[model samples]
Target: MQNNITIRGAREHNLKNISLDLPRNKLIVFTGLSGSGKSSLAFDTIFAEGQRRYVESLSAYARQFLGQMDKPDVDEIEGLSPAISIDQKAHSHNPRSTVATITEIYDYLRVLYARIGEPFSPISGKPVRKMTVDQIVDAVLKRTIELHSDPKEIKKRKGANHNEIFVMAPAIVGRKGEYHQLLQDFYHDGFLEARVDGKIVSLRDRIPLKRYQQHTIELLVDRVPLGWPIEQNKGLQQRLTEAVELALERGNDVVRVILDDGSEMLMSTRFTCPEDGFTFPEIEPRLFSFNSPYGACPECNGLGTVDLFSDDPCEACKGARLRTEALHVFINNRNIVDVTAMNIQTSLDFLSDLTLKASDAKIAEPILREILSRLTFLVDVGLHYLTLDRKAGSMSGGEAQRIRLASQIGSRLVGALYVLDEPTIGLHQRDNARLVETLESLRDLGNTIIVVEHDEDTIAAADYLVDIGPGAGKHGGEVIATGPMPKVLENKESSTCAHIRGDKQIPYPKKRREESKTFLE
Candidate 1:
């Protein structure tokens, strides 16, 4: 049991020198005939007091961060929870908040999609080939070494300088498990075009040699080197890492060295190739690396989403912030909001203001007039959409409220305490139940809700009822009836209680379809 809350000399709104002690942790509903001080008790009395004390308890730095709330005009309130108040009040401006983004679910889904989704080439639209980073590194190294070595270096040491030897490399490794056929395909297509001994020959032009007749020739790797990548315009983070790795791979050695610059030096060793044992096959370098920036889709910046210029402004504003030729006029830069806010009403109005007449007035006149003329039509056409440069935090109340709901909805935080006032104030009746259902979901999250509502549908469904009025104004405030629906009706008092009770036993409050009559009784 909580320490009982005893209200002495209660004088908020309609409460006439009243006092009461209520139980804690109970789903105590405080219902009332409209305008009868239920709101004063729940919001102004309890929630407001709690909010004020919380603000005062914070440190100066924290207080700076927290928004202030005016204290309720009650004498005292105590034993409040570490409370959270959710109301129909909308959120402040924040443009980037969207349903998917506000809820963290979008981030989880993005990772899942990136990992398992099928990928296609951005340029050719072909299925992307998958390879481990190490495998790719190996292939690049092989191609790099082959290209770097000069056949002249081998000849120069072997003293077999009859003619030049052309070292060659292919653009693609033969598709795995298809090497022999790949050679055959290359020969058929005449892809091997370069020469050794000044005679152009296709490497795929195969001539088989019998192993028994073959003289031995050993081709050993004199040196193994890492693959060096060439890139430009990369961000500083990646560039710095790339530079460190590149430094690690630099130096001259006694064995054959293949520089990424495509030069090769053979050390002091020679291999005698029997004129018939080995075949020289030619292949060009394949540049099919996915991680390369050149392979990314240029438009999306690798994010896979494209942007197009929007024809209309955002939905927040219809457009007009002002009339024509206003003080905020800049024919080139001026928008109607600037015109309206800048105190520029008309070009004539701008000219008439003698205060503005003294400085740069002549220069300011034509610029103002031209803008005013365009804005006149824009305003008529309902083009008062937000300007290109509105702050995300300073939007109107309605826009902010919707954005707050959007944020909470996005958070995916289930089971919240949601309190709403007249959420439908600016909305048509068609919009009410939707708001009610939204409130219901928040309550369903195991929250204790206390709505101060006039909407009959919502009020009718309360689990408990406490109607707090005989009437509005100074005449109201006492808890006229406090019980389940059946008990409230037996009493002669509550106007709301009387309506729901259907007392032909008693008269009802004015309904919209009824004949107008003097005296509510």
Candidate 2:
């Protein structure tokens, strides 16, 4: 197998008959002054040829949509791989596009929450759990057994052999506005009595519930004694089952069982709250995606923010970009909005701390792994401060480029040619080391990375260096020096070598200018 990408007689742009052999699967830097044809050689010539070849290998129908690339003016080239370019261009300008959306982290978050998220009432702050008819029956029986086993309660009861239990369906609870139609429906259903706001009211009486105030109403199903003798009675079990079914039907799949001790239990046939009437829809990955209408805030259309004149928080969703119900769903006491709002580092901590029961671990393991891997890649590229909801358009050129780099690292593709243009464009000296380490990590993954860079640290750290200038523009485009770092620096004819060897230097200011208190004219 060929171990190098040999480029011969390449004349793309200002490059003058360039020919070189860049070692494959290595961190190779093309260094020189600006406009010295480093990008020309790395991107325009080599990357273009590699991409064009791969695209041409596809079906003609696919080629039309992809658009054909014109062949570069090169005599011959060998050892090319499928090419991927990571430049300084932002991935998108759509207001709905965010860091999480771009990296697909938000999609996984939705699935995780939907599958395992606990739903609670926004108004009452009570958890809602769905249960089957059998579950409700079992719960009532379990409570009865507990009461019978209590020594103090048994002593209080004395010779009493039974406990009376009230089976009721919550028709309404803590909701504002008049429900006159609902009252009529309950009356028509042959429910002779109801407990409205803790008052037992006859259905015949015209009880005017305040139209604007919140209220609770329960329809009386049956009152029966729960004892071993009562359990043996076939009619009692039948009545209990009928009461549970009636409650579920009348109370929107939820039922409340009240014991003689005044204790209450609520259960549902769906993920719903009988007390608060909160319902959770089925969870899927798309439900968390702002790009999809199912999970997107209807007010902002999943953009999170809105544009009245300029970008501002969305009035409908208050900038969450998800429906209120989605926001109400929680895992570990944090909602979807709260999780996406965290910085990468904080999110990593949260995810690392996340624990799943053994039962749920099998389902959650792969999903959590994928999400954490992408987040780790983002952190490795020094984007720990970026929140998941940060808009892509708000990123700097270098930041955007690094995001693409992070995404590529997460992809884990091997034996590919990656051409990056000025990846350190806006990075501070403090951040350059991490950037260099990131690039080297990619190279170590069996990828050939060709970086067009002017950063001294990057050039120094390169496994192989090609300095393509004695000067810029018309005076440049020749390979002034090519080899390992030491060889490149030792070449007298290379201007970059002269600087690296300390034979030449960019002069610094003799004295720093003093700051003026007032604006200069």
Candidate 3:
């Protein structure tokens, strides 16, 4: 009949007969100094007990391999839901786990892009100059050279044949090198002008290009011949088939004599080769190469950005700029040379002071802003001034920790508990407010947040606060206070009471911001 979750005789770690009642579905923060058994009570005790009980509930066969959690020293607990924990461990891993990849938003976006994107051909459009009407008419009459390789041997079933000739043309023709060369030499210099129906054209006079379409640019022939051979020269097969059917103007079968090139052409409606029993497959347009202009953007390969050599480092860092393994112990994400690159000196000196509208370097203002914006995400998450290309492997514990946090900060999940650890450890006083805002927003989403924190800023934002330390180690573990923010601070016996009520210096405001109040007239 207790009002909420009854945790009676929870002797987990420093918890001494901790008969506590935790309200369901509320933000409850546990606070105390380091080693005050905050993690022991939350992690080693309640979470451990929950896991043990859940696993125990499963069949013996299921529990055999899954292994239940080792029992925590706890008597009883009620009204416990499943738990989710996110610890502060820097996963300096492969870029395979980037912000886009982790949140899965990139995958979703890819589906949207591929489904609705403009499916332009990978090839560029080349130029086709305006040809005079006479010029185009002349071009149509020029060399009607066509060649087809012999059909494969297996296509000899003699089934009704459906041979057709097709020319592959560009979807959009423009002035490219190949098309220009076609007009040069061949338009006038070659024997085409004479063969093109006596329609002579000079490069000088302006003739309308409309005449080009008046004559056929390309033609197709389809007819069947009875005496097709079973086998022949592989290259000469199709030509012979076309010539035979073209030359025979009787019985809907036409055959033509071979051209001097030792090949037959497939033109005119009448044509079938000797052995005429095979059907051919249709050919479709193909992408050259997605990576090459063949199929993708030459600049970004459809990825939208190219990697600059500078952005990718030398092989030493594996292009990471940061060495793969830090041989010596560095205090944080910074090593000796990182000292130079991390231009912003301290937590207080962070970029927030740098105006989005101001700059003082050789780089242009826009460029500086771009650089700072990306690097600032790292810093705002306590990763200031680090280059965008900094390899993940060399990131410090806190730097990597916060970087992972950044990837998830934009999650669309509205009501999922985001249990955070000491989120303010590496952050300076200025960053505490940002951290506080992040937690408060998560709490506002109806999630039951439970933070094991030591930061004063994080502690103050909680809907309900629990202090589990009156001393350290064995001397600690008792619930010193559990109540609303103000009431917890008012508790005479709470260890955190003095920390909040105690006089502490607050930082000077960056700028005294006061909005003008509108008065109702």
TM-score per candidate, chains pooled: 0.43, 0.72, 0.47
Query: Which stretches of model 3 miss by more than 4 angstroms?
Result: 1-3, 50-67, 90-95, 116-395, 399-418, 503-521
Task: Supply candidate 1's per-residue lDDT for 190.
Answer: 40
Residue 202 lDDT, candidate 2, scale 0-100? 76
Model 1 Cα lDDT, one tens digit per residue, 107-190: 322232222223333334333333332232333345444543663443233222122222222222122232345445545654
Q: Which ten residues in a row have the lowest lDDT in candidate 1?
A: 280-289
Arrange candidates by TM-score, descending: 2, 3, 1
Model 2, residue pairs in steric clash: 131-268
Which candidate has the highest lDDT of all? 2
Residue 256 of model 1: what lDDT? 25
**Each prediction's Cα lDDT score?**
0.41, 0.80, 0.46
TM-score of 2: 0.72
Q: Lowest lDDT 10-mer window, candidate 3?
A: 277-286
Error of 1 at 318 (Å): 21
Per-candidate clashes come to: 21, 1, 31
